[model samples]
Target: MTESSPTVWGVGTTRTLRAHWALAEAGVAYETKPIQSRSGETQTDGYAALNPKQKIPFLEHGDVKISESYAIVDYVFEVFGGDRVYRPATSAERAASNEWCSTILMELDAHTLYVMRRHGDLKDLYGAAPAAIDAAKEYFTKLADAMVMKLPAGPTCLLSEKISVADILLMSCLDWAVLYQVPVPEAYGDYRKRMSERPAYQQAFDFNFEVLGVTHKDLPR
Candidate 1:
């Protein structure tokens, strides 16, 4: 690895998983700086200096500091993914990948999955809202139904024959759904199963868990 290898800071959450998985899929050598959110590590003045927003999954590559999980995935792909299997091969494929990522983040992750987490597992922290949880469940069920139709006959990528950034995004979101007990359509359930079996995915998972000293069971459920 060169001096250009990036450093990622975050625990074993879904957001951080995306960054780790993307870097692994891109075949990029990177380092981890695991920030313990529960212990207020991200709120420190030092970490705050790197990210004013003080979010987890912050990334440092060369002189660039990137926040947000999807942006980190994009950065890894753009900077290091030349001829990599995880990138889109054409303009149309790229557009499709972005579209899938956007829809999944906005509709499924932000609207449905996080809402469930806020109400269910993190209820003590965020204050549970029964009505909001119900509404989110309804919305997610519809979204999952639509995703089943949208997903290709996959044991493959979301948009093409090869994996792309979109697959990383969607797989992380689906993992969140399962962790948080969201009902997933059969198609996407199979999709998640297949993607999770990838060597890159396992590598990322192992790194996050080993560094953070947590397992899947340790996550909020």
Candidate 2:
């Protein structure tokens, strides 16, 4: 890819979808490397040179290279979104946005859903831990119970009318949790439906999931 081109590495995971979705929302066109985790793609010499950590959902734009889906989404919003996307304009607004992002990542993703992912679907590689998976599922439901209250009636978003980086992170996690049968909050169903109906989300979903026979329906297992 050229230096000015924005390129995203990896596909077939919620994390990868986050990057793709963010780019779409920001109205930035990018190239996809179409790499999958643990398929000997990230282990290649070329990918090793790009990211020593060998993780998917890495970003390359101009001279900047970014790892982590959350960071990439934040960067895309800051750099490319202009007024097309809503970005926190004040310190307090930023704090509020950060609060949503942090809680979603820690509580919904790493702390619960990811634990279930490692022990459940990926059991062959990570080794099944039924107790851990059960605990994770229970933890997810517990978090959802409290989190549902934070959501507003009708259509919902962390930020009222405008979608923010936090919403993208949340949509990705909610979908992942549902795939794992983690009992995601029912209140979020309509919220997710509305967000998924966005043209940008549809674009990203098609690119990330509709490659050949692979689809989001076949994911997480």
- State the C-alpha lDDT per candidate: 0.80, 0.82
Error of 2 at 22 (Å): 0.8
**20 Cα displacement, candidate 2 (Å):** 0.6
lDDT of 2 by residue, 1-221 (tens): 45576999998788888999988888876788999887899998999999998998999997899989999999998898777777888998888788878888998899898888788778998999999988988988888777777676656566767778988998888878867777876777778778877888877877887654555444332
Tens digit per residue, CA lDDT, model 1, 20-48 = 88888888888888885556898899998
User: For all candidates, what are the clash counts?
Assistant: 0, 0
**Candidate 2 residue runs with Cα over 4 Å from true position:** 153-156, 212-221
What TM-score, computed on C-alpha atoms, does each candidate reach? 0.89, 0.91
Error of 1 at 133 (Å): 1.3
The lDDT of model 2 is: 0.82
Number of residue pairs clashing in candidate 1, backbone atoms closer than 3 angstroms, sequence gap of 3 or more or interchain:
0
